[model samples]
Target chain A: MDLTVTGLSVRLGKRAVLHDISATLRPGRVTAILGANGSGKTTLVRALAGLAPGEVRLGSARVDTLDPRERARTIGYLPQDGAVHWDVTVESLVELGRMPHRAPFAGLSAEDHIAISHALAATDTEELAGRLVAELSGGERARVLLARVLAGRPAWLLADEPLASLDPAHQLGLLDRLRALAGEGMGVVIVLHDLIQAARAADDVLLLREGRVVAFAPVAEALSPDNLRAAFGVEVMQVRDEAGRILPVPIGTNR
Target chain B: MKRSTLILGLTALVALLFLGSLMAGKAWVPPSAWFTADPRWWIVAELRLPRAILGLGVGAALGLTGAVLQGFLRNPLADPSVVGVSSCAALGAVGAIVLLSASTPLIIFGSAMLAAAGGMALLAGLAWRSRSAVAFILAGTVLASLAGALTAFVISIAPNPYATAEIIDWIMGSLTDRSFSEVQFAMPFIAMGCVALLFTGRALDALTLGEDAARSLGIRLRRTQMLIVVGAGLAVGASVAVTGVVGFVGLIVPHLLRPLTGARPSALLLPSALGGAALVLAADSLVRLGPGATEIRLGVAMALIGTPFFFALLLRMRRSAWI
Candidate 1:
């Protein structure tokens, strides 16, 4: 089912963080929310995931109306920080993703094990299965954490700043995986800072500027030079190949 | 080793320490005496048996509380004693001893448990108000010191020197001269608290991903937090009411057993509880076997044992990204 956010506004201690943001994230499509720092990207994602109080609808059902467990099963959320406090193993950490699907007191079932293994293999974290999370590098940790969220197999996945800690190669690899996940009928919504990465991976785009959505459209339309300048205060020069596809890049900030 | 194997090993150790504690006192009771009309049988049944059982129960309680508190607060350094919950309970017990000496043990137990619940409520509130880990721990330290001062004030104002001494001895934490009544008083509360905490294993594991993720995982934040606070308060309060403020078993046992339990808070709970029971029993035995005619207090012995371990953990944690 497609995830939709409508008339969503969130106030953090009297200061508005997200203001009347609305977007329809289509299934089998990767949507990237692009915004300047403090422009409510994280708040918007949270509101969509029902982590923040707001109006979110999963197809026909209002998200907030659903019970938390039901909401959890529908939407897999990965927070900005991928830090796990304990020195837990990668396999154990990934297994926690099955929490919403399994009974609280019941042991993991055969299906749970299958999902966990699939997540491990999908994220290419099988080699790090027995290794402690504390011992892994930043990029490795991110993949393992993503695997943790993936093991739930939610219809919609919301990730906030997932690409922040990853290196260039890992970043491309994870983006490819997210795109592949979207192709498999899961709606993937990610908050990204890199315009180039977002332009390359996202099929749809939602641009926010100071808690307001400037545009929510196809990547080609939403990332127009005028919209980019308005949303990010930058004159971005787009480079296209002979086939007229945009090679996403920002030449400079307009100050 | 597998968590099951570790739990089994710890259980065996607890049994051994329980038996050893029964044998370690100023006088030893023979196995034959257990079934005979020997006066030593009374010692075995009445005195030594109660002490050993209380130590095991109280230790298990503290250890479980420590593990839960660490997970709930997301701070590895959190302990009932260090975070001031134990002192708050002690304050309640001390108040009862000073003013309500004529009152029943049940009333005192109630007061201690209530005060502990209040303290935990306040600490959890402080933690909620501020998301900073440093603020949470500092608030706990302040609360603990405040409770400590209040307990001292109550002791100072006792009606007689003997009463003051009695209060001091209790605060020092001894399994000495305890009867079956004290064990009877604490066991139910501890068990109730433990049952509450035991069910929280999955919630705690979900929490390792942090509050937002845990909430997104359908772990009820309010319910989980309530269970942890009330459960830890009940368990630690009951234990403190009987044994005074035994420090660090909660901190030490969980830290020691976390590796064996895969460092998963859920997996750590049972082993930590078993390890805690063993640690308490062994420490109680050491108190009995020590050189001094006046036995070393259980709380003091634990502090001495646990402080070094705490430093070692701190140093090791320092080398990594624990903070």
Candidate 2:
């Protein structure tokens, strides 16, 4: 099912962060919301995930109107900070994703176990399952946090800046994982600051400027020099890599 | 250790300590006296049995609330006593004793519970705007000090010296000479509070990922907050009304058991409850066997034990730079 947002506006303490935003996010595709700071990328994604107040629909049903558990079952969201208060083990942390599916007082079922194993395997975190999250490195923690979201098996996964603080290799690995998830018929939406990474990994790009959409199109068209300049006020030099993929590298401010 | 083994061990420990509490008073009641009609049986049936039962219920209530509050607030220092709920309940109990001349247990129990609920309400209201841990702790400290001052004021203006003495002794907290009536009065509230707290384990588990992610996982924040407030209020209120303020069981038990439970807030709940029961029973029994001319009050004994542990915890936290 496609996730749709229409006429969505969000105000955080009298300051409007997302204004009249509308987009249709499809299943089995990765949509990267790209913008500079304060462009409302997080707010837009939060609204789509039903964490913020807005009109969002999954297929035809209003997402905000759906039961919280049902909404949770369909949409998995990861915040930017990804705060873990307790020093629980990685396996236990991943098991938390199964909360929306399990009945109260019921132990993990066969389905939950399978999902957890799949998430661990997909994220290459099977060996780290027994280790405490507090002891994990930044890159490992990012993967484990993503695995937690994946364990829920939600149709749509919304992650805000999941690549922040990750090394280059880990960033590429995460993008590959997200692409693989999309290939397996899961809708993946992520907020990204790296234009090259977004262009390489995302099927489509939604560029925003000052809480308004500058362009929502396929990566090639959406990340054009004009759009990049308009959205981020940056002059980007598009360079083709060995795989013949266009990579936009920001050169300087668009003077 | 395995979760099952830990739970079983804690349960066994609680059972052993419970039996020990009944047997190891100032006058020892041998196991043979339990079956045969020995005059010492009265000590077991009438006096020690009720004390032991109250110890179990009150201990479990405090421990479970401590774990729940710690999880809910995402603060390790959070407990009924630390967050001023116990002090507010104590204030209410003191008011009832002063105003009603300690006429009825029901009046005192109800007043304490109501005051605890009010304290929780005020705490929530004060800290609602800020999600920061410091704000929550500051609000709790202010409420606790306010309640403490009111309680002292109530004591100062007591109608007579006898009432003042009784108030002071009760405030020291003891399980001595308690009968089945006190158990009947407090047990139901404790049980209800425990049941409510147990239901929050899954939510607390979800909350380990923080508020936004927990909400995305379908944990109802408001409902969980309500359960914590009501649960702590009733549990701590009834405990104070019956045995006065039994300090530190809530704070100490959870911290001691967290390592064994792998620091998962949800996993720590039951073990903390059992550990709390064992700790209180052991402490109460130790006081009974003390060399003092009179038995040390349970609250005073717990403070004596807990203060050093708390200091060590703070020092460790400081060394680790957690603060």
Candidate 3:
């Protein structure tokens, strides 16, 4: 199904974080929101999943018109900081992702159990199932949470800086995983601080500055030196001359 | 171990301890009496047996509800005492003791339930309407102190000979003279509360990542939290209504169960229930045998026991980099 956004606006604390932002994403594609810190990247993705206050009008029909309960079943979001305090087992933590699918009083059904197992396998956490979350490292926790998101089998996966805490290997590994999910016909939208990584992984990129889209197009035009300098006010160089320009680093700090 | 094995072990421990509580009271009875009726065994059964069982039920309810509240609020310090549900419950029991201490058993139990529920309603409003955990604790503290003062006011006006004495016991918390009927009355509310909390386990797990994160995942945050508050009130408030104010069972039991369940809120719920019941029952037995002819307030005993236990836990946690 086509996921379209039209005339979407959001306000946080009476300040308009995004004003009239609109875009469309296909089912089998990776879309990226590239921005510096505090540039409203987190808020935009959150608004799409109904985490932030915003109007999500899909064409003429309002996304807000859908029952929030119904809306939650179709979308899965992994936040910037995966806050955790309890020391629950990895299996239990992942199974919680199945909440929207169950009735209030009944415990996990057979279908729920299969989803939990599949999630553990997908995130490579089957061996860590019995271990307490407290005993695991940050990377392990992130993987478990990703497995949690995947358990829901939602149409769209929205993640905020899924690569931030991960090391380079895991970062690249996670990007490949997201790309694979998109190939499986799931819409994957990620808010990324790493422009080079975003360029490599995404089909379309939206560069945001001051809570508005500075550029929205195929990754090629969006990652050009002019766009990067305008959005971040930093000079950078690129390498790959493909559909997307890679910006791991620019030529020099000196203009 | 698997979830099934841990749950089984916890259940077995509760059963063995449940038996220990029955046999360990004053005026020890023959071991054979436990299996069948003896005329002499009737006295023990008639008096102390019900009190200890009631303690188990109340303790279990306290622990389970505590686990639920702490999970939902993401605060380890939450318990009925911290939230004023216990104090309000005490006030309810005190109202009966003050006006008609010798009233029919039914009236005393009924009044206790009503008072505790009233107190719970106030605390629930504070926690539900307000978003902050610190604010919830503050509101509970204020309500508890107000109830405490009101209880004192009622006592000051009383003309009975024991009013002054009973006031102290009521404020502190106790398990003395608890009858089978008290247990029977509280069992349903506590059971229902336990069911309510367990059912919300998935929602609680979603919450661990953050409220916003949970909401985006399609969990109805307000609805889930409201269920938790109501469940906490019934389970905790009814528990205190029966046994006065048994503290720490709630705070400590979850901590103990978390390791086995691996710290997920959903997995910890069942273990907390069983573990809490066993702990309170064991502590109740210990205090009964400890250096006291008069009954020990179970609440007082738990605090005395909980400190060293908690200290050990903290030390282990610190070493493990739990902060």
lDDT of 3 by residue, A86-156 (tens): 66668777877887787665688999899888878877788998887878888888888888888888888
Task: Please write out the lDDT profile of model 3 over residues B1-323, one tens digit for every residue.
Answer: 68899999999998888778777766666568854667647755765677767777788788888888777777766665666767777777778888776355566567777877787677777767655556666877888898889877877877776776766676566777777887788888888878777877767777787787777656666677667666776787778777777778988998877757766677778888999988987887777787658767787888887888778877875776445
- Kindly list the per-residue Cα lDDT of model 2 for residues A1-255, writing each as its tens digit: 999888888899989888888889999999999988999998898888887778999999888778889999999999999888888899999998998999997899999999999999988889999998878998889889999999999999999999987889888988999999999999999999999999899999999998998999998899999999999999989999888889999999965
Tens-digit lDDT track of model 2 for B1-323 = 89999999999999999999999977999788995689999889999999999999989988888898888778777777767888998888888889888657678777787787789899888777664445666888899999999999999999999888888888899998788988998999888888888888988888888888988999777677667767777787788878898888888999999988887788999998898889889999999999866999999999999999989988887875234
Q: Which candidate is the best by lDDT?
A: 2
Q: What tier of docking accuracy does candidate 1 attain?
A: high
Error of 2 at A235 (Å): 0.9
lDDT tens readout by residue for model 1, B1-323: 88778878888889988988887777777676786898888888989999999999998998898888787667788787656778899888888878888346677777787778789888788766554445656767888898989888888789998888878887888788888888888999899999898988988898898878988898777777667767877788899988888989989988888767777888888888888899999999888887768899999999899889999999988987768
Candidate 1 lDDT tens digits, A1-255: 878888888999989998888878899999999999999999888888887778888988887668889888889999997768888889889999999999877989999999999999988899999998888998899999999999999999999989988889889899999999999999999999988888888999999999999999999899999999999998888988565668568888887
DockQ for every model comes to 0.82, 0.67, 0.55
Per-residue error for A146 in candidate 2, Å, reads: 0.5
DockQ of 1: 0.82
TM-score of chain B of each: 0.91, 0.93, 0.89
TM-score of chain A of each: 0.96, 0.97, 0.91
lDDT on C-alpha atoms for all candidate structures: 0.86, 0.88, 0.77
Q: Can you tell me which runs of candidate 1 are displaced by over 4 Å?
A: A241-244, B121-145
Deviation from native of the Cα of residue B167 in model 1, angstroms: 1.5
